[model samples]
Target: MRIVACLNGDRRPGAHPALPVSADQLAADARAVVAAGATWLHVHPRDSRGGQALEPQVVTPLLAKLRAAVPGVPISVTTGLSAEPDPWRRYDLVQRWGALPDAATVDLAEPGAVEVARLLADRQVALEARLGTVQAARILTASGLADAFAYVLIGPAEPTVAQALETVTAVEAVLDRAGVALPRLLHGREQTAWPLLDTAIAADRDIRIGLEDTLLAPDGQEAEDNAGLVSQALARIAAHA
Candidate 1:
């Protein structure tokens, strides 16, 4: 099982005081997380104005800095529609990705998911299919693309521990019924975050954590930064081990 660090999310700056917004800050955080034993990175690039931007120019520089800071670590970017609602515009940005991240996550529940998956395949980029619902998992499985992308078994942003566990079980059941088998990463957000991560560890699955997922540590204390989150996550993984 590997640990992925999600540096910054599509969330606004005020969402977390430690969320990295600038390119330099993102690179710095990348270094910190990598040093803390993160196997991969998931980042949401922001423009100079501090808004999520999918433009190639905006994405390339930031990714370049991260790549330089943490050489050889796989980096994934978000292609979710929350930042750019227009599917065509999102496609265009992906097409124009001058410096591509090693992988990108596409929510299967979103419109144009299959198209984005195909585009990623065409470019030889790794795809992580976000499974938000059972229906979404079924859609990905039936698309004949399940074998090509990794699965992200995501739960509710702030569900109870029981709800999060049930969500994971349901997703696993769907995948089993679909006769699908692929690498899977499990993650949840807010209150469900650490609990679900523990679940993932027990299940022997890859897991992710960072400011995008939670602003607090397992002890209910606010995280100081992305490194702090990674350090705490590593500690959890070790405890489970």
Candidate 2:
């Protein structure tokens, strides 16, 4: 029942109505989503100019405020390529984090993913392995670093639902063959979000949903906010559970 509420992704504030950008805004939404039954939070801290960042200056204050806003729930941030593309710079940024999120995603699709992941492991920050493609999963398998992560998240990059599901199954099967038994967290982006969520539900795996996954509800209507999406996900989890 790990309902992760992703407040905002790499997208700017203008991408969605009231998308949380500032520290204050993200803190407010964190409290709101927790109240709405979200057990975990996945956040994107923004810089002064409103772009996602992993710089110590940008991430420190945000983590401080979030810890105050929602005291107990686990908070995670992205180490995805979108935040900072340069692998070495990304490594430097994460290495110097003034305050660290409880956990952080290390997407294997990006360059130097293994190196970055090893750094986070050395720092004792809990890891979430983001496998958005078959190649990423293979990389994880080849690296033999499955035990370092909190879980492996399958977020398919395929455009169609069938293709996405197929890739998810393939990735899982590959990991299974590699003796990687970490719990799986399944999600999809935009058009594939709801269907993949259902797939995760029926399979009884951990599921993530929020603006990062989609801007609309299951009925194809625009969602009010992260809380609304969490509420919807909770309802569906109940029904499927």
Candidate 3:
């Protein structure tokens, strides 16, 4: 199972004081996480005010810096609608990006997911479909683009561990039934983060950790940084093996 370290998401400034915001900060964190044993990296490139921004001006430099810091590591960026509500604008930004991610996530729950997936494929960027529910899985299956993706990111935003696991199972069943045999990257947010990480470890699924998922570590202490969270996760994975 490939362990991915999500350095940052659409987190606002001050959400976590140690959260990486600038290109330099993100690149440093990327290097730290990889050294801590993460083989994959997911990040939401940010703007001057630290909010998620999909514009090439914001994304290119951040991606360039990350590639420089972590050569050969697969990097992914979010194409989440929250960053750009207008589908045309989002598509345009991605098309114009000077530097591209090795892989990019297209949230199936979002509008224009199919178009985004096609654009990524055309650009030779591997696509990871972000399925948050059975409905999203069905949408991907219906689009007949299952083979266009490299992995299915089962990201359940459910607040409780039970709810999150249940959702992941349901989405998995849907994909299975549709013969979408892509490897899955399972993760959860906020309170469900560590519990789902434990689940992923037991299941040997592609998993992720960092300030993007939670500010607290598995023991419920404030995580020192992305590297610290990743180190703890790698230790748990090693013990499981």
Give candidate 1 misplaced runs (Cα > 4 Å). none
Q: Estimate each model's TM-score.
A: 0.96, 0.98, 0.98
Write candidate 3's Cα lDDT for 58-103 as tens digits. 9888888999999999999999988888988999899898788999
Relative to the true structure, how large is the alpha-carbon lDDT of every model? 0.85, 0.90, 0.91
How many clashing residue pairs appear in each of the predictions shown?
A: 0, 0, 0
Stronger candidate by lDDT (1 vs 2): 2
The TM-score of predicted model 2 comes to 0.98
Candidate 1 displacement at residue 200 in angstroms: 0.5
Model 1's TM-score against the true structure: 0.96
lDDT of 2 by residue, 1-241 (tens): 5788888998767889868999999999999999999999998889988998999999999999999999989999999879997889999999999788899998998998999899889888899999988899999988868788888889997889999999999999999889898889999999999999988999888889899889998899998999999899889988975
Model 3, runs deviating above 4 Å: none
lDDT of 1 by residue, 38-68 (tens): 9999998898889988899888998889889
